[model samples]
Target: MDKDARDFINEYIASLPWLTIIESVNDTLVEDNYVGKIVIQSFKGDVEIMITIPQDFPLKGIQFMCIGITGYPHLMPNGLLCLNVAPAGNLAGELQEHFSKLRTWMMDYYESGKQDAHFEYYIFDADPKITFVFEEDGQKTRPAHCCGRFSYTSLRQQEISDERVWLVTGIGDTPSRFSATFMSFHQPTYEGLYFLLSRPPMINVNQGLTEYEDLLLLLTEEQKGYFFSTAASISIRSGYQTGCIVIVGYEIPSLQSGLQELRWEPFFISLQEYPLKRDPITDEIIVRPSSVSRIHWCKGINASYERMFGRGRLCSELTSSKILVMGVGAVGSQLAHSLVRGGCRYIDISDSDKIEPGNICRSAYTFVKTDIPKVQELFNQLVGISPHLEMQFNIAIEPILDSNKGYEKLKMYFSKYDFIFDCTTNKHLSIMLDGMQLPGRIINLSISNMARHMVVITGVSQIHVLKNRIYNKISPDKREPFYPETGCWSPTFEASNSDIAAPLHYVINELNYRLEKQLIIASFMIVREEMNHSLAYELTYDL
Candidate 1:
């Protein structure tokens, strides 16, 4: 019977042009009462589709329709087939109209034979829900369920010492009544309770209660235990409303047991009216609302601010400040170390060069070995010294010249800083930084050739100094060249000379100038002069 049905379906398919587009067909017999059949079809327009079916002989004409088409109208999983033959829902009523058009589409696919095509399809009744179960670590348990109730009139009457006055106020206001109930099976600590209530979908604990009447009280130990062991309830009365209440409590184990035994568990119970139900085993009853709603408490300011400051100074003494270091070399390093020792936190360090062996003579990293990435190593070292310090290092100065790239990053880095430093010898970088319209004070330091001498400059912005008289006081021509050779002494001139030069000419010159007469010292003096001038200018400008 299966063989006859297969032959008939094959004939029917063969009669259609679409079926000719199919490249290969295969059938496999299974040992367990079933056969698997597959049809692989290659369409002309770079489209190929393979269809598989169980050989049950079509009870519903077709078991599965897997149509692969070229770029034309595209096959969709929905029965509303999109084909060039009919634009809409394949609504052609006549059998000839539908079959002829389908055959034509197949013929087109067979004839086109082009391969540059994309695939898109829609499947009807696709199950959107994920069916497979996946294992995940740390799944959160559901929050303990809770409800609340309060009666405004009953609460007011309870508060009243004079019945006539209470009646007058209650009748005059026609006060809206309120009640609240909360249930939990876990007895979270006081801290945990605050945390749970502080999160969204609950009350904002940060904003304390506005009215003195807003209060919370701990229910009796029996009531608390009753709430945690089972579903329990409470009854509350306020001026406005009354309803069922659920209560939760948290307990910390005694210090003798330590934190190992500390557990935060919740107990839940409901309260509707009158005397609350008591559990038999624990002998704990549901808490009355009046007993748990009259306590007045709030988070302290000092405690809140302490949480904000983390490991820093007392909240009252804390101030937003900045430290600027001009050069990121040895002396600057030592100075930074000193400042950190002095309790100055938050520093900005800048250097444009990778650590080199040549820099060892005077660099802070001289004792340290070579090949270490300097900025990061220095950062780690500084952080080790003072973990609270916020330090930033900028390795590139070119970006500073290219305003588009540099300004934004620099502005963000320096926006809230209180000080700036110029430890760099790169004239362009220094000048560019000095030229910036800064909100904080500027400090600069540089070492003469080697570590023989050092100079420090402190100044304010040019705008503050000049008072709009002239924006820039220092001219481009006045700025010192970065390289030693380009400075006052030219290497070319020294090289051209004979008797004055030695065998290792440049090295001898450097040693002679730096070591003998102390050229580095002299340069440091020059830097000191520049610093003095800068400080003078800042002072004058401030005036």
Candidate 2:
């Protein structure tokens, strides 16, 4: 042990009058190895406390534990007393404050019998090697008992370690794959059973079931029949492994609104050993009468659309809106990503440009490979972000603009979407799209040379009117544009991702607000970044 840690421990032992140290650090039977532990009688009766100062000393707080108690509100199965307490200036003051907090925690446990009403969950003793992910909405009602199947895409090792990890995509009655246009869905999936109970099946107040026979006993007669019947009917394919997962769900009251929410706990079992056996008379396999197979409780990851994608509050319009982004360039790609991240499900992206090396600095395209189309790479990225996102990518929109009878095709195609955004910054294309006077709402989004301002023109469909408004409202670039390639004549604007993201986020927030409020009118909106780093929004209406 370090000299500082030893001095602190000596100081703590001498200062704390309330705690009587029964076993000192010199005792080998208690904790022999490291800085050693001081077992003290800090609480009322029968509950001993073990205090150990970490190597970092006062920098990292001390560790405390109840010697032999389990299944309390704040106590872990191994009797680790989990308390969040701040440290003091000196070791003496720190020890006193920690002991005070421990006393308070013990008092609360003894008096109220529960420390936190909202977070008190049953602890199951099982391995977390396998995990099952499912969707959960706080208020969604589910069947009392049902068989569910969930599809998983891949099993790969974690980056830092060789530990295997599984990613479950979609969960339903029949297994479904995560939809993606760019990626194939040929991965393996598993079928599982679920039971909904009034409350969690527990061995004690806070300890959950850990054995298959115990779980069967906890279930109702009807539920037990359902389990046996399903287990018996389960067919083990010739080459496949015989195993399945069982998820137990129960309602727990939320302390905030006093409403009940579903809590799910999964347990995996090998069918060859559990809920299945060979008959005594005939050598045929049958459902087992009783078995003491251990329940392998898995870690549950909530991968529901609402839980994963909902950014706190989601607008219904954004979720259901069919958005068409005209270009997947810098501004366009970021806008498309923002829309997807903000809960827009159905989006179509159109672009003719390939992802260049220079585009990586400002755009969302992370790949540096040559000749990959912008729409293609962007589609892959969006699919990675949200697999359930419904998106279609057109390699080039310029050809459709030039093809014979293309205007009619454009009109027909554009009419299918609810909102069309011209992020191409191509004046001719924007004018043509606006002049088409398509059924859907047309909004043109463009940024200034240095990302100083962003423009959004909504509701105007006339060619001349949109042209005049754009010429009048949009100003010339103050800073000069540079060519990305040495000899290439394509002069693009200069701005980092941070510079563009600030204004783009402002524009997106305003767009969502206007969309939700049904205030998307024939108006011009400008989002300008001030010298003070605050965004200033200006909205003007058409005459």
Candidate 3:
């Protein structure tokens, strides 16, 4: 031990005449910590204490516990006294206060007169907090669930061992609620019960307690035998794993009736082991016969989802939302992927183009998707992003205004999504789509003239209105626009995917924000001249 710890230990021994040193620096059990124990002599009874102090003396305080007692008022599983409050000071000054608190805990067991005292539960070495899942052959990952009741098989490890591993399998709503199939022979099976508790009594056993007689009355002799053999704690699965137990136990007005009448809280407890008594009449070990619910396999996928995204309503809403993408080209591909990551549940894609090798410089999908159609490739990509994602793909044969059949089909397709994105930059197609009545809100996304501009028209179906707004908000640059393609018959603006990806991502994120803020246009351009330096080549819409 360090000098500070030695000094404090010496000081403690000299100051307390009643205390007897059992082990000095009992380093074996608790690893690399000072966990020396002491015994105290008192009139009421002989009290055994386990003192744990940090190696650092004055900086940290001492932890005192009274062990080896049972019955009346709940005690911690480890036999450590739960101090509601103790003095907050250096150990030299507060050792007496720590001793005094231990004295109080010691008296709690004796002061109460038998049955009137609160019930005490035995503590186990395992993790008190538990979310029970079924261990099955095919679906080991899923949680064990039943709407009302279920049947299951089980696998148990050898008894009298320190390790406790119980597998509850084959759960479902069957056996007619009174099947004696498993009762014919004794097999290593799950004999556990499923009941709700008022509090998470994993550690604090006092707050939530269901009567032993009440629980016993509900089970049969076979079940009681199984329950007594297993860990004496409740296992909670379903939506309660991520701490719904606390709310159902102490809060939630709907559960107040259960608290007042049934006195059952939504928590858990464990009695280390139940000692089975032999039947006096028959020479066999006595066990009650009850078809208590045994978990077959757990269906924890949805419960896991709930635990992950249940924190906020907006996230859950986003995951359940349906989105339609009219184009899977340059900017459109980036937008679709962004929306998917934001928890969009379903995305319906429509595009006439295919992913070409040349489009690799700007589109989200890489060269591997080149030969395949853009809509189909994007659909496959989205499926890979989230295996649970629902997606659909369609080839846009003609623009909405070109043919009556095309317009009707497109209209029906648009109706299914909560939001729509018209990402095709074709002017004729945009005007045609604007003319057709949309079933939902449509957002048009595109980049203009050498990727110097990103255009997004929300709510308004008129392409003319978006054009007018862009002209009014954006400022004119002094330099003439530079067309990117020289060899092609119809030269198009050349912009790298990096230069466009940010703007496309920004547009999708802002679309999620709604049209509450004015759209700001930002673009980067290169000024070619006799000299390498020039005036500011970037423009933005101030509004």
Number of clashing residue pairs in every model? 59, 0, 26
Global lDDT of each model?
Answer: 0.35, 0.65, 0.50
Q: Candidates 1 and 3: which is better by TM-score?
A: 3
Per-model TM-score on C-alpha atoms: 0.29, 0.79, 0.46
Ten residues in a row with the worst lDDT in model 1? 177-186
Mark the regions of model 2 whose C-alpha exceeds 4 Å error after superposition. Answer: 1-6, 9-18, 24-45, 86-97, 119-121, 138-188, 193-198, 221-242, 253-262, 271-293, 310-314, 398-409, 438-440, 462-480, 513-543
Please provide, for model 3 over 1-543, each residue's C-alpha lDDT reduced to its tens digit, 9 standing for 90 to 100.
Answer: 466656666567656666787876443436545777788776767777777766664456666666775433435545666664455565655666667665665555444332323223233332323323232121122222211222223222244553332222323321211112212221323333443233333323332223333433444455455444433332233222222111011112121223221111222222222223346787344332332221112111111222222343234434576777887887788877776666565678889987778788888778887788898878767655543356777887355454665667766756677666777756676676567656666666767655666766655467646655674555354445554445644544567887677666555455444332434322222221233564233323331
lDDT of 1 by residue, 1-543 (tens): 255554554455456554443532334444322222234344434323343324532321122233443223433432123343332322222223444654554455445533224322111121122111111112212133322221111212133342211110111112111101000111111111211222111112112222212212234353344434433222222211242222121222222223211111111112333233455777655434443332122111111111223354321111235676655655555555555443455666666555666545545565355766566556656654543456666554453663566586776666566655555555565555556666765545443332222333445443223211221322223434344333474221111112111111222233234433533311112211236445211111121
Q: Decide which is better by lDDT, 1 or 3.
A: 3
In candidate 2, clashing pairs total 0
- RMSD in angstroms, all models? 27.2, 5.1, 12.8
TM-score winner between candidates 2 and 3: 2
What residue runs in model 1 are displaced by over 4 Å at the alpha carbon?
Answer: 1-320, 357-362, 366-369, 399-412, 449-453, 461-543
